[model samples]
Each structure stands twice: as structure tokens, then as C-alpha cells.
Target: MAFWTYMLRCVDGHYYVGHTDDLDARIAGHQSGLIGGYTQKRRPVKLVWWQEFPSRAEALAAERQIKGWSRAKKQALIAGDWESISRLARSRSCR
Candidate 1:
């Protein structure tokens, strides 16, 4: 079974990162407010990015790593700007 690391652009303009075995169903739950917590109140989210992983552990790891990233980093990711993502990571580490 495939797992996924996904990012959602919330209606409030914030991003939410999560891992799921069922991308479609999970996204539907979030859209319908069936999934609680951060995304629940920030309903009406849009799937902006996602990556498939061979294992749930890898997907979860990606989700956790992304969750710790700054908004700029996340935006770079959503935009598929690998150069900017690398630059941002380097700059962040130098801080």
C-alpha cells in the first residue's frame, strides 16, 4: 500500500502537513470537517502538494519534517522551488 505526505493550503492561508494511507479519503475528511484540530476550524482546505512514499513511516517522517519548516520554506516547497528550499535551509541553519 502506498502512503502519502501531503500539504493543505487552508482557507485562512495557513498550511497543514499530514501523512495518510488514503489520500483521497483523508482529504475528504478534512474538507468536510470530519478531521478535527488545526484543520477543523480552518476548514475548506485545498490540496496544494503531495508525495507518495513506499512506507507509512517515510510519509510520517516527511510530514513531521515539513511541519517544522518555516512558512517560506513551505511555500518554496509548494512552488517546487528546490533551489530556494536549499537556500532557506542553509540560511536557517546559519541563524
Candidate 2:
């Protein structure tokens, strides 16, 4: 089965990161507010980015890593700006 690490742009303009085995169903749940928690309160989220992984562990790891990233880094990722992601990582570590 394919697992996915996904990012959602919430109604409040915040990002939500998560991993799921069923990306479509999970996203549907969030859209309908059927999945309670952070996303439930910030309904009407749009899937800004996602990546499929061969294993759930890898997807989960990606989700966790993304959740810790700064907003600028996440935006860089959404824009597929690997150079900026790298630069941001290096800059962050130097601080």
C-alpha cells in the first residue's frame, strides 16, 4: 500500500502536516470536519503538497520532519524550491 505525507493549507492560513495510508479518504474527512482536532477547527483546508512513500514509517517520518519546519521552509517545499530549503536548513543550524 502507498502511504503519503501531505500538507494542507488551512482556512486560517496555517499549515497542517500528516501521514496517511488513504490520502483521499483522510483528506475528505478533514474537509468535512469528520476528523476532529487541529484541522477540525481550521476547516476548509486545501491540499497544497503531498508525496507518496513505500512505507508508512517513511511517510510518518516525513510528516514529523515537516511539522518541525519553519513556515518559510515549508513554503519553499510547497514551491518545490529545494535550493531554498537547503539554504534555510543551513541558516537555521548556524543560528
Off by over 4 Å in 2: none
Backbone collisions counted per model: 0, 0
Candidate 1 has an lDDT of: 0.97
lDDT by residue (3-51, candidate 1, tens digit) is: 9999999999999999999999999999999999999999899999999
TM-score of each: 0.98, 0.98
Per-residue CA lDDT of candidate 2, range 24-94, in tens?
99999999999999999998999999999999999999999999999999999999999999999999999
Q: Any residue pairs clashing in model 2, and if so which?
A: none
The window of 10 residues in a row where model 1 has the poorest summed lDDT is 35-44
TM-score of 1: 0.98
Worst 10 residues of 2 by lDDT: 35-44
Cα lDDT, model 1, residue 37:
92
